[model samples]
Target: MNAFLQEVLTPGSIVQLATLASLIASVNFGVVGTYVVARRITYIAAAIAHSVLAGIGFAVFARAHFGWDWCAPVLGAIVAAVISAIIIGYVSLYLREREDTIISVVWAVGMSAGLLFLYYSPGFNGNLESFLVGSILYIAPADLWIMGALGLVVVLLCLFFYNPLMAVCFDEEFARLRGVNVPLYYMLLLILTSLSVVLLVQLAGIVLAIALIVLPAAAGLHATGKLWHAMCLATVLAMIQSTLGIAWSYTVEIPAGPAIILLSAASYLAVFGWKWWQSLRAASSLPIRS
Candidate 1:
């Protein structure tokens, strides 16, 4: 046990660092997943996750270095992501007429901005590559701590504002009628969504954060009807995938990012298939009356 603890003590070791990341990722997914099912807006998560790259690029370019400090990338990413969120939310609300058009532009522009920054940085041809395909095994202890702290904040907020957030995410009109600050909650959700992107980018990178955020949540959500319970189950599922995926990656010598995603995909498919089989069995068991 002492030896095991020592192994995890290092930020570079696969066991210790990845374990922290797995927990951080699980909690992050649980919070984001709640809105995902409530709003039925899976696409929004994907869109924002991709578009966040633009904001991160701005942060990176301003600093002119990736490894200087985690704070730099995080601040830059948050600014870009929140601005993008506002643009996406504003267009979807007021311009409801051409919302899709506006959203597409938001996503495209963010990604393009990142690409341009990558071009300007010397010997940075792989900046885009790093964001797209993360190396899970390379996660730093400081980054894990950052993600864990962010996860705690998100979880606490969700606990305090559960009813308000649910009211807004699931039904804005009802929330407003109940004297809730519906718009405020909506804005808060989007801002936090971007923040989640920042925390996750550190673990799964920009490319895989969406998968980590949405996949396990979707799987558990689709299989269950209860909101809070679904979130719990999703957290467990995500944790399992993250831990197993890391172990598999270490053993197989594959990239941790892809490994985790592939495991998540497999878990989703397995649960989906099992659910479908149960439905079929239940349907067949209902006897027809002549």
Candidate 2:
């Protein structure tokens, strides 16, 4: 265990990359995740994440055929996530009818299209596996830089617009009455959420990234009363899970994303069980309301 820690904590190793990636992801998750849970928009995050695969697949295909040096898969993912966010946001925020159906369609089409693109991308689509299931253990330095920049942006946005965001999350009608630009802020939240999902693609992949963003926040919110407090707790929990997952991955020689997600799942269940037990005890202790 000590040796594993040393290797991962080394200045620049795969384990170190995973650690850094987790930190970056935790920050974004903490901020955007708060809004996601508060607004009851966890589905939006899942949609953006799953839809991002289409962008990645397109980027890979474009690079192969058109040699668009700038069309990195990550870039494609961001574009796709943002676009999908806009569409989904518009539907949920305005259309309001059949929103779930639309989102479900987007989720399926995006993934299906992505797979088709990957099928034809030139030689060795093995790299695509990382986008599917995450490859934090093999994260590139460039990706880390992207994660850092995005993390900073998420923090700054949250700090600057905290109240407005909270207003929108808690009650859109009330926020609108208060001149909070509900529609604009709503879209902004979705965009930010998409960015969070994109950063997580390398950490947890399209299929499982939602867990990293949603689970920690869910646990934190269940334990805290304030949004900021929940966000902080969520960040800490995410760090713990990511670190433990990476270490365990090293020991068991398994995929880091799955390992991390499994730990998160276990923690969530524990928290859930504790909460249930506490509620039961409280009910038993309460005066019988004959």
Candidate 3:
């Protein structure tokens, strides 16, 4: 712990970047994650996260073969994530019958395609593990700028469409009856979720990205009834989890992503268990009736 603090206190250390990245990423996690949990679209978000590897792989392949140095992996991840979100949204909205099967196919095919592309990309691909599992401590300054910009855009969009999104999330039929363009808002939510997934992927990698997105929001939802309150609490929880995860990972010489996720999962379970106990106590305290 002391060593971790010392590193954090050091002038211009990578730990500083890691801490900042987690804090910035938490905003999207809390905001979009609230919508995802409310709408029960964690599956869709998971599909988008895994599918991002396709874009990343293709970006690497293109950069190697076509000499497109501008197409960075993160850029590819954003493009692929948005496209996956659209496809998944369309299926959920219009092709309701085969939604699960189609989403599953997308998830599997995306991963397969990514592996194939990476295999044929003709390079060392040293950061492949980091891409798959995450390496938050090694993030570049450029990555921080990109993440911050994306996070700002996500927060602003959520603020702008708060009412319609809340309606769509809780009661789509009612929202449609009220002329809210449910489909459009639903798609918009999915896009925002995709962007959030991308940010989480940078911190936790594709394999654990869904956990980071859902756990904090789940804990927040359990802690509060209102949507905005849940968002606020979830963001705070995510920041704390991220900070602790970074510190724990440093102290234990483990990976930051999994460490962070463990803390998030523990917090969620603790909240859930506490809520359950309270419910049981309330039930026990109820007046007996014949």
The candidate that achieves the highest TM-score relative to the unseen native structure: 3
**Which of the two candidates, 2 or 3, achieves a greater TM-score against the reference?**
3
Reference-based TM-score of each model: 0.88, 0.95, 0.96
Candidate 1, residues 20-62: lDDT per residue as tens digits? Answer: 7877878768777767656766566667777877766766665
Please tell me which model should have the higher TM-score, number 1 or number 2: 2
Segments in model 1 whose C-alpha atoms lie over 4 Å from true places = 1-14, 65-71, 123-127
Q: Which prediction has the highest lDDT against the true structure?
A: 3
**Could you give me the TM-score of model 3 versus the true structure?**
0.96
lDDT of 3 by residue, 138-244 (tens): 88899999999999999999989999999998888999999899999999999999998999999999999999999999999998999999999999999999999
Assess candidate 2 and give its TM-score to the true structure.
Answer: 0.95
Error of 2 at 193 (Å): 0.5
- After the best TM-score superposition of candidate 2, give how far the Cα of residue 219 lies from its true spot, in angstroms: 0.4
Q: Which 10 successive residues of model 3 have the least lDDT summed?
A: 122-131
lDDT of 2 by residue, 35-104 (tens): 8987888988898899999999999899988988799889999999999999998898888987999899
Please report, in order, the local distance difference test score of every candidate based on alpha carbons.
0.75, 0.88, 0.92
